[model samples]
Target: MKKGFILIEMAIVVAILGILLSISYINFTRLSVKSNVDSKADEIASMLRDTYENGNKEMNFKDYYIEIIKNGNSFEVSLISHKNSVRKTDLKDFELNIVGQTFESSPKYIYFSPNGEVFLSNEKIEEGYDYNIDDKKFSDIVIKKGEKISKKIHIDDMPLGNITVD
Candidate 1:
């Protein structure tokens, strides 16, 4: 046997390195995509939670709610008070699945009261009760970043609703 490696051996080594590199690249891509999806979901959840928790502290009488709507290629999450936007966040590269029925071209909404109640409609907020609160009217907001990756933001549609993400 010669001291140096043959041409076939060199070719095999290069091919193996290329294969490994490709695999690593693919894995990195998948991880990056997953990270993006998770990051967006967390951002959304935080926005909703912050608004729900602190919104009524300043103006207890003002109705506070979150508006989530599809805006072209991105989604818009706006915290609304007295029919005006308090804060807005725009997210890209995802889809928002509103489990509850939207009100006639209006955005999906989660209204909050000073008493910690959550409602899908703000129309009946001042009436002191939701029009329908049968314990099964929970509205789900699902954010999906592809066919395989997704996150759910469950907003309990009841007297005292909690915002949670996963």
Candidate 2:
């Protein structure tokens, strides 16, 4: 009686395993890309909220603004501060990348007043606004004075069509 499997049988088993692995790898790559984009969006929203909340604090409050700059496949988030010097200088400008994503339109700058209100440059964001990317409208970040800050992601034809951030 034979005590071991034939060479042909071993090769067939290995080939089957390889095929299954390749299929799984493809699916995982797609899911991961989607997740990265979603998380980056969330981070931007959260940063805006934090800046607003901390704007009124007396410890280190000095007019903070967020500037989004896009260059090809990468986007940068800049944290800028306006100092009341003799020259009215902009100080402490820090920038970071969005990673694997780019803005659909030109750069946008949002300012947070000392009273914790949202503003586009010097004017307040009285009505709601939509942040579009790649020519697709993803969500609306509403900024109404004397009301709670809220955000909603519109998933019309997005990659993750079922995702909604509230």
TM-score for candidate 1, please give it: 0.72
Clashes of each: 0, 0
Can you give the lDDT of residue 133 in candidate 1?
41
Residue-level lDDT tens digits of model 2 in 1-166: 9799999999999999999999999889766655554555566565555454445454233355466554554456555544221111111122232223233464655554333334343222333433222332223442111122223432223332133354
* TM-score (all chains, Cα) for each model: 0.72, 0.50
Kindly report which residue pairs in candidate 1 clash with one another: none
Instruction: Tell how far residue 59 is off in model 2, in angstroms.
Output: 13
Tell me how candidate 1 scores on lDDT.
0.67
lDDT of each: 0.67, 0.44
Q: After superposing candidate 1, which stretches have Cα over 4 Å from the reference?
A: 58-63, 81-87, 102-106, 121-137, 156-161
The lDDT leader among the candidates is 1
RMSD to native for every prediction? 4.0, 12.5
